[model samples]
Each structure stands twice: as structure tokens, then as C-alpha cells.
Target: MGICDAPARAKVLNMSQHNGSFGCNYCKIYAPFNEDLKCRVFVPTSNLQPRTTDEWKKLALAASNTKITRANEREFLGVKGWNQLLRLPYIDIVSFCPPDYMHSQLLGTVRLLLAYWLGGRSQLFKYNFHMVWHLPQVVRQYGPLITNSAFQLENWMGKIAKQIHESKIHIAEQAINKCSVISSTITNFYSNIDCFETEFIKYF
Candidate 1:
């Protein structure tokens, strides 16, 4: 599962960013930026439908086939082009890749919601608040928390960085070797965990 920020997710999926008209990954709604409120607001419609993996692939493929300078513009949908990740049959490009909760919620959604409640734009606050309610639907569809988070990824990255003793030379090789060693250590520990538990019980 690819857990990243909205912008990073967009880059990975080869789609438009969050601020774009068709930016929402889950909803196929055209959210235009309201200059007065300074944010993209979704217009509620009876026929609003959730984005499906099959639909996404078709749109993405069509966008890529356009072969224009601005292919994303050519396509009404926000899809830019085909991504290498699409080759994996198991990974549903729509559902598998979820934005990290911390960045998408705490720093993004919650922050904006708070701003609305704090009385910046009193007249349009209610309308904007209702528009932002699509988040709950997203959570229900994708789940509240993903398998991975930014913190966990950052920690792993730090460990990998520390494993490299040299500055620039053979860094990739060193990282791979270090990761292999770590993986083996973890495997061995897990393989012998039952034996260790039995020994502990016998001795104690």
C-alpha cells in the first residue's frame, strides 16, 4: 500500500493534484476553487458516484493515448497518464493507494474545517462545511486508518540512511545489503521465537 500526501499520491498515480477540478481520488466530482473562500468546494448532486478502478484505468489510458502537450487538459477527467504501478494486477490503483491520515486529515482537512468554524467567511461557512462532508464517505470507503503512516515510513527511511556509512559511493548497494541483513535477522528471530519462548518457560 502506498501511503503518502495528496501531492505525492497525485504524482504516483499520474493524476491531477488536490486543488484541481477532478482532484478527488474517491469522488468523480468536479470541485472548483472558490476564490472568496480560497478552497475547492464540491457541489452536491444526486447522481454523485464513487470512482471505480476500472473506470480510472479507462480514463487514464485515454488520457495517455491523447499524446498532447497537456494531456490532462484534453481529458475531462483529472487523469494525466498511465503509471508503472498499473502493471500490478493485485493492486487496484484506486483503492490500494490511500493518502496518509496525518497529512490529509490533521494538517489538511481538520485545519480547513477549523478555519470554517472560526468565522472567516460567516455567510458561506455552512455551505462549505456541508461540501466538505464527503470526507466521511471517503473514510467509510477507504477506512479511517491505513496499514502504513508517514511516521512509520519516515522512521524506516532514517534507519536506512543510518545504515549507510559512506557518503555517496555505492549508497544504493549499501542500503540493499543493510536491508537484506535486517530482513534475515527479523526472519531468524521469528523462526526461533517459539523455541525461545519454550526455553524461557523451562528455565523460569
Candidate 2:
């Protein structure tokens, strides 16, 4: 197979540098696995059993009406239902989503999620962005927690953000190299469908 058109298991094992426009360590493991041809696997459900008639009726009623909010956390479980409804027939939302919004939101989400999964916020890893983009917006959306981070503590960070704002091609490169929070943010981003989309889907 051609580059990035191989098996997931094999791609991950390669661990060598990826020859691409952007140098991503994770892509060395993931890019090749994504041939952009194979379909996503359907998830098996509840021992592959059917819901009883009343269960189906209850679900139908639940689906027709509801607005989700943080106050009504349980209702937002609807994201799983949305995922189930859309998983088939191809659900690649990447191209459909807004590039600027995604660019601004994705990096932060990925790092936050990783921090929670690996252990906690303190256990983040270092990454290397091309330069940076809408970090102020990300910090605003995620809360003030990032304000206390070592990555944001540098005196020159304001200048870096200015650079990102002025030159869209560049990004917050050094933040990832020295800060573990960036990695944690990445993992956190992919963990929850609802939380992620709710916080930043307008960009998409």
C-alpha cells in the first residue's frame, strides 16, 4: 500500500518520523492507518440484542423532544444517539466543519483529554505545533485554568500569540515542546462527543 494506506497495527509500530508537510509524531502511527478508503466499523450494541417494544416507544418519545444543557446532563447523552444515527453512510465531519474554528479548538481539546486519561492535569506531555492560533479563545472556553500553566507563563507568550494572530501559517510551536498540558488537552478532546462539540462545534 502507499503511504498512510496501510494497516493500523503496522502503522503504529513504525514509530519513525513521518514524511509529510507537517511533522506529527502521532501521524507516524495514525496517518498510514487512514487509507481514506476503508469504512468505519459498526459498533456492536448491548450484546447485540433488540430493545423491547416499550423500550423502543420510550426511546422514540425521548428522541422527538429535548434540549441539552449542562444543567440537564442526562439529556445530553443524546450525543451517543446522534453518533449511532450518523455512523453509517460515512460521518466524516472534518471537511464539513469550519477550518478556523476547528484549528482554534482542536489542539486544546486534545491535550486536556489526554491529561485526564493519563492520570490528571499535571501528567500532560510535550508537543510541537507549527506555531499557534486562537489560543486566547481556547483558554476562554476551557476556563481560566490554563492561565496558571507553565506554558503560558513565559514573558514572550503574548508576543507568540501575536505572531499566531498575524501569520496564520505559524503556531504555538514551543508550547508543546515544553508543556505536558498540550498532550493532555488532545486526549480530553476526543473522549466526549457532546462536551467537545458543545464547546467548539460552531467552528465545524
Candidate 3:
């Protein structure tokens, strides 16, 4: 149900229909519906399963450059039965194609800000600029729902950065470690607190 970027939709569409020759698992057409509309679902000719990295890369490329005339349907179709690649019913694919708020809102905003500040700078700035891509993985590891943009880990990172700034820490790793220690201490403190203490603390 969660999609990271526009490429995800493309991948889904590609899987649904390999080029224009094959039918889609979710929709009848090769193209996706409008942003406000939803695509129709249909039982796939084959079963779904995990694909190799090369296959996924090809699919991604196909999705991005849709004009490429290629009939690689055999590569995507399963041996038999409905594909279980996503483990979701065919009907749910359209509803699940919702825009990813974390990418569209939080990450997009941060990326724009970074670009404005360091558009054409040194290699270090370029590296720092691309570091935003790692954020989603780090956030997912912490067990937060990726779909809910409001609960993004970037907010917490912002707070940590603010603390780092206030502390005048020259080293990034030390600041990150400080934030980790602070978070663990707070979590441990709460874990031992009684319900009454929790309520009292909430009022403050």
C-alpha cells in the first residue's frame, strides 16, 4: 500500500502489463489512471513472486521510460494462478496506490531546501544532498508507519539537529550519539514510571 516515489507506480504499471502487448494485473490499460481516479483490478494470468534485482531494475527502467517497445511479459508472469508478488488482493492495488506523504511532503521539502542552499557546491555538499535517501530506511528500522507522513522521523531528526546546534558540537557522530543516548534515557525513564506519574508528567 505504501509507495516511495513515482517510480513505484511505474513499476506496478509495468508489472501489470509488460509494455502494451500484455494485460495488466490491476488495470486493462497500459497507463495508470488520473491522480484522482483509480485503476480497475483483474486477476493476473500468473502468480506473483519475488523478482531478481536485475528484473526489478529492468522493470523500474521500463516504468520510467515507458516508450520503449518491449514484450517481456514472460519475465513477469508466474507459472500459474494469480500472482502473489505483493500478497495483496487485486482489488486493493488501486486503493493502495496512494501518494506517499513522507516522500512528497517531508523529504521533498528537505530536498528543495538543500538544493537551494547547495545547488552547485563541492563534492561534500553533493554527498550531503543525496544523504536524504537513507532517511527512509533508517525511519523504517525504528518501526514507524511509512504511510503516515505526519509521523515522519525527519521531525525527530530536526529536533536532534537543533539540540546539536545548541550544544555547538563540531562532530556529527557525537551529536547523533548524544541524541540516541537522550532518547534511550527518556524511554527507560518512562518505562519505570507509574500510570499516575505518566499522567502528572503529561500535564507539565
Question: TM-score of each candidate?
Answer: 0.68, 0.17, 0.26
Estimate, for each residue in 1-204, the C-alpha lDDT of model 2 and write its tens digit. 011211221232221222222123211111122234332222222232222323323433564465544455233222212223223344222111111222222444466566677887432211222112223433454323232233322323444344344344334554544345544453443344345445564654
Better of 1 and 3 by TM-score: 1
Write one digit per residue (lDDT tens) for candidate 1, span 14-93. 98887777776766777767788687766667676677788888877888778535444735478888888888888778
How much does candidate 3 score in TM-score?
A: 0.26
> Ranking by lDDT, best first?
1, 3, 2
Error of 3 at 148 (Å): 3.2
Ranking by TM-score: 1, 3, 2
Model number with the top TM-score: 1
Evaluated against the true structure, the overall lDDT of model 1 is 0.65
**Residue 38 miss distance in model 3 (angstroms):** 19
What lDDT does candidate 2 reach at residue 47? 36
Candidate 3 lDDT for residue 13: 36
What TM-score, to 2 decimals, does candidate 1 have?
A: 0.68
User: Which candidate wins on lDDT?
Assistant: 1
